[model samples]
Target: QQQVKQSPQSLIVQKGGISIINCAYENTAFDYFPWYQQFPGKGPALLIAIRPDVSEKKEGRFTISFNKSAKQFSLHIMDSQPGDSATYFCAATGNQGGKLIFGQGTELSVKP
Candidate 1:
């Protein structure tokens, strides 16, 4: 089990609203969890991450809530803004391979 699947292929949220996306994985061996944010024509950058050891992790307006037992995780954006519109990806990596398995991709748009 080394695959992670994400949903909603795309999402639209009003400015100052909350944006939520979900993801699930099958590999329990994964130890590293990370989210990447990418803008149009730009490479994805590490936005935030959480390990199975922690139930949740947050940074600024970005938050990652994870459920290890359920093999699921989600990303939440608070006070979403037009500037925050971008493609979000959920990924996981095991100690054996530093390489990350990413979700298909989720496009988030915050309308002003």
Candidate 2:
């Protein structure tokens, strides 16, 4: 109930395409859901997030869709690009200051 598992350890897409990644958790106690994008040698930054109360959230070209009942969520990158190629991680925080749990990293490569 405290782990987030991500798929497709790596992905490749052409520029201007859509990149989709999925993650699921077993814990229902998780309240704060966040997706973080990280570039090489940089710390993960919060990209977009949603709570159990919300079904979906979007920010610019990034969108996070959450499924409370199924204990799952996903990240969709619109207009995939070479510059967008990087590692993305799905994370969760149960309460304030609760250590964020991260899914196995995903390497996304958008070919130019």
Candidate 3:
């Protein structure tokens, strides 16, 4: 199972509020979990990532939580701002050396 399931296809949050997005994977071989953020008309950029060894990782206002046992991971954005509005995607890759499997994107709209 190489699929990554994401939830809350769309989300709206007020400025300074917290934004949460969740994802789950079925592949146990997956070792790398990465989250990407994309703006309109732009390519997705690496936001944050965590390995199965790490339970959680944070960068700036972005944080990624990993649960290897549950085959799940999530992204949390603290102090969400209108400028933070964008689409986010969670992806996983295994040691088999294939393309990363991506989850359905979540559209986030942060209101001021």
lDDT of 2 at 35: 84
What is the C-alpha lDDT profile of model 3 across 1-112, one tens digit per residue?
A: 8799998899999999999999999988899999999999999998988889999999999999988888889999999999999999999998666578999999999999
lDDT of 2 by residue, 16-43 (tens): 9999999999988889888888999999
Candidate 1 stretches greater than 4 Å from native: none
The 10-residue segment with the lowest total lDDT in model 3 = 92-101
Cα displacement (angstroms), candidate 3, residue 52, comes to: 0.4
- Positional deviation of residue 87's Cα in model 1 after best superposition, in angstroms: 0.5
**lDDT on C-alpha atoms for all candidate structures:** 0.93, 0.90, 0.93
Q: Arrange candidates by TM-score, highest first: which order?
A: 1, 3, 2
Query: Model 2 residue 16 lDDT?
Result: 96
In candidate 2, stretches whose alpha carbon ends up further than 4 angstroms from where it belongs are none
lDDT (10s digit) by residue, model 1, range 6-106: 98899999999999989999999988889999999999999999999999998999999999999999999999999989999999999775899999889
Clashes in model 2: which pairs? 1-27
